[model samples]
Target: MVLLFRNLALLLAILLPQTVQAELVTKYDPVIYDPEVPEIVAIVGTIDARTPLNFSRALEEMPRATEVILASDGGSVLPALTIAREIDRLKLNTTILPDTGCYSACAFLFFAGNERASSGELGVHQISSDSGDLESGQLALSDMMDVLSDYNVPDDVIVDMLRTPPEEMHIYTPEQLATLGIIGTSSSRVAKPTTPTADMSKKDLAAAFVQDFNRLWSLPNAQAVDTLAEKYALTVNYYGKSLTNFAVIEDKRAFAERWPLREYLIEPGSTAINCDELTCRVETIVAWQTSAPERGARSRGRALQSLTLVWNGSGFRISVEDGTVLERQ
Candidate 1:
């Protein structure tokens, strides 16, 4: 009887399920885009089972983080939902840059942002179970709908999400995203400058400034540098003398030669702008790297800089710049 009991116990142990360990592969880091602006917390990689704990740790480490930038390929569902709720709870603004990609479960967290903006792709697909069970799939879909509803996502958007298959993706365009209230909303918090421009709204001008600045750093060649320099007034200085005419091209080329491969990483929501009728000031922290790591001479670091832009009748141009570049410790 004892032997039979032991055999039965062994069979039961073999049949019963064991606790599954959380698989976390997400990378969280603090990014200071501008010393004067609030810090941005970056969350990258796959949101797996361990993401919830990882995100919790990040929040605990950077309690002052008021914004979050996400670049993820997606992963497990429950953990993503947990992260989304946490983001909502913290009331952080979330943003995805034009070069970044957020998909599947990552979209959930993006949608949960109190003030969300996406200049890149936000992809979604139906939720499914690994076992391909219809009941489990339905339950998963239902749970997703519940969360989406809680986030106040539109019914049409939720319908489209349901229609998309797990194997395929439905990427939301900027226009569609606007309709979904994900972007294009001007913050009431932005104080209007004493002299606002009539030609372009402050929001549009700010967007243009960010886009142009990004383009300027992507390929810091002679032509790119020249275009950026043209945006600066003739009185703008490089080292000491003004960067005007031939001096502009020469100085830019010299700088480009030193840093053959330059890259600037901007933290989302780190851009702070103050514009008046004639001038605007933009400040941000940038992680600037001016070397090719593959070539064994890479020097990468962060700096805080401020650009003063003046409206030149037709458009805005840089009038002055605080040349101080404080390297990040």
Candidate 2:
């Protein structure tokens, strides 16, 4: 009896942790950590329904984490959406390191990140149905839109993303992503070119954009992009952005143009301020509306557009265009 009891106790001890681990697995399964960025967890492999257990397990462990590195060929959608929401809640940065690819449901996960980035080859395709019919395709599109809406993706943009034929996928670059607001502006945090030498004649907006662009690609994540954008007085708005080659070009141009008129929201009692064409200025305006007198009055406000200014040897050039401003006093 003594020997039997001793064996039972030993077994209990061994099984306790396993049981607890199994319970945790119900919500989360497995997660991988990298020694280089110990704060960053690497999530690779099929992220489908089968993988959700591991994904959940990893998420519960990673909220306190700084980053999540994701790379997958694609898999399930519902689970991926759930995983993405957790990433957003943790406010952790989601990135795809260089040469890593995030496809299908994995791409949706990328959208959920507070900061989303892709090193290279970030592919996002339309959702398909198990039956592979137009009705199924429509259903899948509707579902993806719902998921994107939860993440604050603009309805129009989500619609555009779904435009891909059931047969084709939507691939994107970090810059293309930033414009649409699908990928946050945090990607700009990478590196930026400093003011040109005294003799340099031209504005290196392209170079500057490129520097930030590469940085985002190097460490794709929503936080990183947001950090960079904030440093430069830049912000991204995805409300009306879309996914298309032409749309991509237009978005980049919007960044390059940085027009205050197009960028800011104008309201009564608001003033626009575009700093002088010098002094590496950031252009923006503030506006606020007093509530009308009747019953209870409320205040309305909006922010104007902002420009990232840099000293060109000739003068100041509006090198970068961020999001439109809102009403603010």
**Candidate No. with top lDDT:** 1
Candidate 1: the clashing residue pairs are: 33-285, 34-285, 195-277
What local lDDT does model 2 show for residue 97?
A: 57
lDDT of 2 at 32: 58
lDDT digits (tens) for residues 1-329 of candidate 2:
11112232322233234334332122332255422233556565666565656755554564456676666666766667777777777777777655456777777777777776654556665676656678866776677777676666543244435666645666665555554456544443322233346654223432333233334322323333332332232222233432343344355444433321112133333323333345333333434343333435445455453445554332233344455535344
Q: Which stretches of candidate 1 lie over 4 Å from their true place?
A: 1-38, 184-329
Task: Supply the TM-score for candidate 2.
Answer: 0.45
Where model 2 places Cα greater than 4 Å from the true spot, the runs are 1-31, 35-38, 60-63, 131-140, 185-329
**For each candidate, how many residue pairs have backbone atoms clashing (under 3 Å)?**
3, 30
* Model 1 alpha-carbon miss at residue 58, Å: 0.8
- Where does the lowest 10-residue lDDT sum fall in candidate 1? 1-10
TM-score of each: 0.45, 0.45
Error of 2 at 296 (Å): 61
